[model samples]
Target: MGAHDAGTAGRGRGKRIVVLDYGSGNLRSAERALAHAGADVTVTADLTAAAGADGLVVPGVGAYAACMAGIEASGAGPVIAERVATGRPVLGICVGMQVLFAHGDEHGVVTKGLGLLPGGVTRLPAERLPHMGWNTVTPPAGSVLFAGLPADSRFYFVHSYGVLDRAALAEAGVRVTTAHHGTDFVAAVERGPLSAAQFHPEKSAETGALLLRNWLATVD
Candidate 1:
């Protein structure tokens, strides 16, 4: 059993949604999307504030090194560390997802990630640079993470790197793969209560909204 299943041994009992804001991210739109899904989300840069919140969304954009620095600087790092320790759901998106791993190989810069999940982040296949477009995501059989989500659902993506190795894929209990420019990448991931999606569900039209709605349903 992973940290999520262990920490969340008892059912969740809170409505506080903490969305981390270090320097940049699409939190504003994510907030709008979550609200549309009936979630009362709270956006903050304070790690302390995020630590105590019921659920946390670690979203990021731009440089991975800079984002990690911002998260550490804001003190949200330990909060996330603790949250992961608690087994409560902590979702990271895009660069946010990269942060969950031990490290990343981007911009020739190898920096440590949240180390929440067991693995390292690597660059996407050479065939694909920054995968920027729409694609279909097919989730694994036992995945309820995308419960009610349509199969082969299309989602918008603009990412350069993704989880590539099979071991890394298994770390994510429910493996959700998405195709980008003929290359397959892990679109959505969930390791126990810890979940994340490289594609911006907030921008994924109905498919994205369905993901958000499903996640929101598990918030409390």
Candidate 2:
């Protein structure tokens, strides 16, 4: 069954969630946000805790290569792959979401990613370097993440690279969300137990909180 198929039944609140501390993400901020969303949150590098939690959050920032290095250094790469392989919930944020794809091309340097999604990260076609500030997104119909969120609600984003093509992801039955920052780019995605957001929901205020709560409801 898809992650949302698990349903919100018996979702008694305080789902145990691990915000992976791989040295690249805003650990404390993510932890606090998840906590405020009613999750029993933990920020740690313990793979055991990560694997065993009801939900695993992989938050990231900065360069793709650096985040990958931290994931490898912390031995989180395999654990994340394993979780997705077994149908456990995994959420990737910002560069965290970017690393789920096959590769990332940053300034002529190509680095490998976790390959959970079928695509590559590239520079946005926008005139601006980083697409910072608030922007609206177009979530697919029946989107669990965007459920209960207003259509015009905006989220915070800060990045230069993004996955531009959604064909492969859509062909694979992944629910794709899009946003524009000089060009249309992937804003979020969901398939089974793996969900990711290119924007920082933690910094997105109420819209983000509702999204986090929606994600938490999917955890078994």
Candidate 3:
């Protein structure tokens, strides 16, 4: 039950993509961006709506633990897992991407994550903290997410913690894209049925729009 049917035009013309409202994320911005990218977008917390959508987008902001709590409270974690299990598409943004890992460490505290990816999030080792603002991404070969984009394309980022284990992700057969703050960290990940970005695509302007379009193309 993807968004658009077979007859719809390109982009998300008839597609039904849901922006999960798990009590986190820049919902309106994401919704608007996806709509512009041609999806029939809905921002909701309804489990049925999330599960039934053609494609699901899990967007998040703030702490990893708080986002995970909202996902649990909304009963959306199982829905996301089910979607992944069934080979349906799911995209996570920012902390949405972070929580998909095994766990996240903020300050000295650690919290369990969705454990979808075999990794943990930790503070970026750069000289400066937060790793905010725009940075260029180095997409892997044959990267569907970065397809048609420039090699040095910049994406918006506002993060303090990220997945730093590139080797583990590669060993797990996940396609990765990296960006450097002071050191390298996972900027994006593309595994079967699951794709996530540490940066906010909705806030990334044209480059972000193109990335969303690429992901939307895989919805069917």
Model 2 segments more than 4 A misplaced: 1-12
lDDT (0 to 1) per candidate: 0.73, 0.92, 0.90
What CA RMSD would candidate 2 show? 4.3
| lDDT score of residue 161 within candidate 2 | 99
TM-score of 2: 0.94
Ranked candidates (lDDT, high to low): 2, 3, 1
Q: Which parts of model 1 have CA positions greater than 4 angstroms off?
A: 1-14, 126-128, 171-182
The candidates, ranked best first by TM-score, are 3, 2, 1
Can you list the residue pairs that collide in candidate 2? none
List TM-score per model, in order.
Answer: 0.86, 0.94, 0.95
Cα lDDT tens digits for candidate 1, 1-220? 4453333322232366778898868989887766665566788777777877768888988777888888888777778877767777788878887787777778787988888776666777757567787877777776656775667788888878777665655744546554555456667777666788888887888677667656755665
Screening candidate 1 with a backbone cut-off below 3 angstroms (N, C-alpha, C), the clashing residue pairs are 47-76
**On residues 39-115, what C-alpha lDDT tens digit does candidate 2 reach at each position?**
78889999999999989999999999999999999999999999999999999999999999999999999999999
